[model samples]
Target: PARRPPPSARRLMAEAGVAAAAIPPSGPGGQIRKEDVVRALEARPPAPAPATAPAPVAPAPQALRAVPEGDRERVVPMTPLRKTVARRLVEAQHTAAILTTFNEVDMTRVLALREQHGERFLARHGVKLGFMSFFVKASVEALRAFPAVNGEIRGESVVYRDRYDIGVAVGGGKGLVVPVVRDADARSFAEIEEAIAGLAKKAKDNRITMEDLAGGTFTISNGGIYGSLLSTPILNPPQSGILGLHKIERRPVVEDGDRIVVRPMMYLALSYDHRLVDGREAVSFLVRVKECIEDPERMLLEV
Candidate 1:
């Protein structure tokens, strides 16, 4: 004989379509815990016919058993980090006058540069040469040229930042976290790569702290790693803009001599708070990033 369960546990079992007698007690004094009910409910199969009366009725189809409802669904509460992300996303939508500008860049030169210097760079820095450092440096130059992208609206006035602290969005075990790269403008490419690698490791291992996640004037999200072809990213709160980078693909395009040729291309999206940045400035800022990415040397020359 089984002891009666608490009102709440009984209600949960009833809702889960689990019989009180079916679950074994795992709590103290042979009491059935709510978790016991949940586990039993999750494991219970569809009801079969009576042992002696099953000859007349056919079994339910396998497809029917796969229908998603009741026992098929398991609900869990949102984690605190997920809740925070949701709140900030909604707040960004409501608070900022957001707009996304788009462009595409030829990656021929950047790829060539990487192929030429990647091995030595990796040996020297102990971190693989990656595309992120190039983009970070390019973004800094563009931010310098178009200060409005780095500016934030504080109450009634706009505040401009002189130093570049760029946030790189990384997927952590908890959720999407943006860890800031401090003084990115002044850091060398190797230094930027090393910092990004360290921050990424911290994020993945759940060692990231509040200081690592704060004080970013701008953000860059690389959806390309996850195979996103193009997407309009949302703004992070208090920050005026975020740059979305997508997968690089080989596409046919007209080159300098109007000859149709295949080239590696990547689509770029810049999502900005329109209240602080004008459309012209936003477009120009993206174009500047494109120029630097396409030529890499332009970033060195500060052009």
Candidate 2:
């Protein structure tokens, strides 16, 4: 004789739209308990329609189907850091009027400069001279030019920060983490690269601390390494602006508005809080960054 689930468990399964036959019993003497019914509800796939239902109600060819028991989908809980990131991202979207502006930078000079001095720079600094340092320096210069982009809205007052602490987004073992490069305006290019490297190591090792991510006047996210051609990045909360760097690809461009030549170019995206930074300021800020990158000497000359 097969043991039946208790009346309460059966009622709960019915109320939850779960079939009694689908639930496995785990109670004493093979009786189905309420917990067993709840587990079945959580693990259940969408119910199929009755055989007598209309033929037109059939699921589409692309609709999901249940797999074998061994190939069932696994449900894993989100970590605390992941949960926090989710909440903050939603909050940023809701609380700020966000806008993203795009621009493209010709990487001719920067790439040439890197090709020439990259080996020497790495030998001296013990770290590779990556595009991020250039972008960081460029961002510092841009922020200095457009103070409004570095400013945030606090209550009814616009809080403009004098210090430039740039946040570099890095992929961590748990998820993405943004670590700050403190006093970026004062740091040398090599120093900025070193700070990013160290922070990235800490993040990969899952040793990144709250203090490491405490505050930032601005953020930079480079999706170039992952082969993204272009993407509009979302704003990180409390900060007025974020710069997104994408993959550099060879594209034909007119030189002096006549000669077409192929050159390596990268698209840049500046996502800012429209509530604080106007469209003109946002566009100009991105343009300033492009100017610095296209003419790498401008960053060195501090022009």
Candidate 3:
């Protein structure tokens, strides 16, 4: 009589790298039960033990082989998200036209203005006055002067925006997010601060909505927060230009009439799409913004 395998046979087979077949029992509609299979396998398992073999004698220890110094070591596997990020970053390098330009500015005037007005500005408006407001205001004015710097290539046609929608490059608690301040041109300094502060807070909390992140004509990245003295900021995709703000340090700069004084100086960068914006226009536009920030009255006057 052919016997059935034990219930534990599947477990033993799985461990030994062998397949286990389920055997049906003697009933009309046959079924394998645990009690029958277990009894059969347990009772039949008296196979002869290998006739007591002699223990092998121990050999002497062998010396270890030396490894060459030039062997390249460890390799780690990349996750799916990491692979995708790497591919997209590489793809941008091949297709996009990238260029970086740098300039230094005396932030003495801008900082002074902020210091003089910050407390009162915050007290009245419920938001602190930050450097971004000055840059946003100045950039909007500069874009008006040089519209091409704020333009993008669309199907062989250049599209320029009449109004400004500035993307504020904000820091989350960890990563970075660019939240757009729509119609930045029409807003006042206080309004800009309020909007930027709200977006920045929301971004940190990961509560920034899609509406807060879309539609921007230009971008401003403030690397100064991380103490970066100078850096060429990348253009935020569709936007043609990005202004980088750097840390301010006290440097002896020549003021009016060659008066060398230790003033708060900062490095600024305007990286724009050269294909859409000419060198003269890009540099000139940055210079105009610098001029506006340097002379606060210039912001009030249409210059």
Candidate 4:
């Protein structure tokens, strides 16, 4: 004869986060996940009783009680788009050889230039002038000089692309998205800003398309929006390099002739696939980028 479970224990345990105390009876096979345990402990429970002489006080109710197999029925369930993301993240971890190089750029020059010119530029062009356009132009120049950063490896083959397609990072409530602006090398700052604005607006509206997410030769993650001082960003799939932009803050520093002065500074991080890039090559490429950005005239001259 099959033994019946203690109905009193089973009924009390089903209420969620119930302590296992005086549970009459229950089923097996359902241990709570650790996250669930932590969540359960966060809520206060009743105070303990005074010391007892000795009664087998039923064990405190469990964080969770398992449902009996006989109680389950076959059912179809919906799936999430997360599996595709998981597979790509796992693949990036396994196959790609990753490396990150760090550098800092004094934003004093760039910020002052923008502050002096941004309002007029915006009014004249009807678009807000932003630093992304400056960095994107600099990165494109570097990518051209060090084509390896823009190239990818396929089964021991070096594939180089002459076109520059830069990905701009945007944030929404859910997570970050990178929308590409193609032929970035050929576009002016105003054009780049227009493209960035449209993509960011679309991302916020949850209306970004698959095409907008494809074929990015390089990625720039502007974590500055969240006020991160510095971070090494992960590579986007099929792209060999990512640039991390951090918050611009004022800090004191020594200038030429050994005088201390406060200046606006921002940290930049370049993370690339080490399998396809060398440290010397990577650092030099970033140095060139920094030079172009700090001295905007070099970018205008296309030097």
Candidate 5:
């Protein structure tokens, strides 16, 4: 399930070194959103005047008069879905030893591959080839390479999931929701795209059921669609890891033989429950994803 706040907002709070719970959420259903973060920063109280400073002159009589109350106050109760998101996030913070690591991937190859094969693929599957399938397949490969990232802690034991059930975060009318793609590891790229398309439709239409939202081993949240440049994702309860995708921008970088060129780059963040997955495992998992996305053929070849 998606957290009460978008993962990007939570990441912003962490990056600013602020307490997550202390900030007030102005988002729908009292969830902290990106705008709320900006508001909090802008509204922060300035440092108090020094004790030695003179107690300045009093305000004019007209300025001293109490200002009439304006129509600025409003309250909305939390929806059940939002309440569930809040409770689970707090529980995750208290229970899991959460940590996040980041990396950047060059999307040059993936973009080229899509452009070359997209037309044929669309004609055959009746769906346009998109980036989600590449990432889903890449994630499945990465999860296979590092099972700990897919595993969850149960009581005193770590449960390793044999099958890949990935939750793709989508925005719905109510709030953000995650619908699972069952057995993702076994699905082809076209299949993955179609599944995501169908699920996203159901989500936007508010027709997704509880069964669609349940039982996921891992999750992928793409804040890039909403223009987030980078973010550290929060873990969904019981799951050990979640991946965050950010906006792709063209940036210059040095390649082999001291050659510099501009390439489409996207930042990736992996947040894992350190209680179950180690730093090495988390880092390696992210690297594996980067490799697969950088060379889409690796997924097709099962390399």
Candidate 6:
């Protein structure tokens, strides 16, 4: 005999317009919990429309296989992590006055620096010198210069953080997960590389814990690795800003004296909460990042 859902669960199912038989019980002793009701609501199909005149439909081309309609489509359930991501993304868009600002950076100096020190840095640090370290360092400098970008909006107030806990977005086995690099401002290049590597491995193995995904003052998402040419990254909630990095390509540009030259350029986008950060500050923050990447010495000099 199956146990019936409690009165609270029944009320929830009623409010959600789902039938009791439609929800599966996962609670102890075959009881339907509120969570089960919610899942059912999420999975429920739309109600059929009232009967009306049937519209003419076109026949499928004979060349197109004769496979059944069901065989051509598949339905898969969203993982818990993916569901949370979807919810948070929608929440961020709805709650915040989100805006994106774009800028292009010449990666010539940074690439040269990497090529010059790749072997030695790897030999000493046991982690290859990657572009992320440079970006993280540059972002730290930029965030420090524009504190509002690193701050969050708490009802009626803007909270600024002195510590830099940067979240590096990585694709995990489950989905995309952002694991924080705690106190990034104090970490050396080697330490930052090691931290990102460890977090990436954990994400790939699906062994990341909630603590690793906890509080971050800012987030950096590198879509360049996946060959994304350009994209506007959405803000991670509670954080005022997110930085999106795109692919580096050789493009012709005008230099000093109007000389056209080929340069490796990467597009940078800063998506910020307009409620907390003004347009001037957001643009300045992105420009600051561009300057640090282009020069590569300003970050070292604390400029």
Top-lDDT structure, candidate number: 6
Residues 16-116 of candidate 2 have per-residue lDDT tens digits of 77776677776777788865775565455555556895558665476676555787578676665675577679879999998899999999998998899
Model 4 misses residue 137 by how many Å?
0.2
RMSD, one per candidate, in order: 13.1, 13.7, 19.4, 17.0, 12.5, 8.2
Could you tally the backbone clashes for each prediction? Answer: 0, 0, 0, 9, 0, 0
lDDT at 254 for candidate 4?
Answer: 93
Model 1 stretches astray by more than 4 angstroms: 1-71
Local distance difference test, each candidate: 0.88, 0.88, 0.76, 0.78, 0.87, 0.90
The model with the greater lDDT, 3 or 6, is: 6
**RMSD in angstroms between candidate 3 and the native structure over all alpha carbons:** 19.4
- Candidate 1, residues 17-129, lDDT tens digits: the string is 77767888876777887657655653455455468843576767976765456556686666545655776799899999999999999999999999999999988889998
After superposing candidate 5, which stretches have Cα over 4 Å from the reference? 1-71
lDDT of 3 by residue, 1-303 (tens): 345444444553443343334433532334434323333443343455588878996664567555568878886555322343354346445545767777777787888888898899989999998889889999999999999878887768989888799999888753577889989988999999999999999989978654576568899999999999889887776678889999899988886888988888888899888888888988898888888888866886766
- 170, model 1: CA deviation in Å? 0.7
Off by over 4 Å in 4: 1-83
- In model 5, the Cα lDDT at residue 296 comes to 88
Q: For candidate 5, lDDT tens digit of each residue in 113-140?
A: 9999999999999999999999999999
For candidate 4, lDDT tens digit of each residue in 30-114? 4333223223332345355689787665664678685677796775321112333454567677878888999888877788888
Write down the lDDT that model 4 would get.
Answer: 0.78
lDDT of 1 at 104: 98
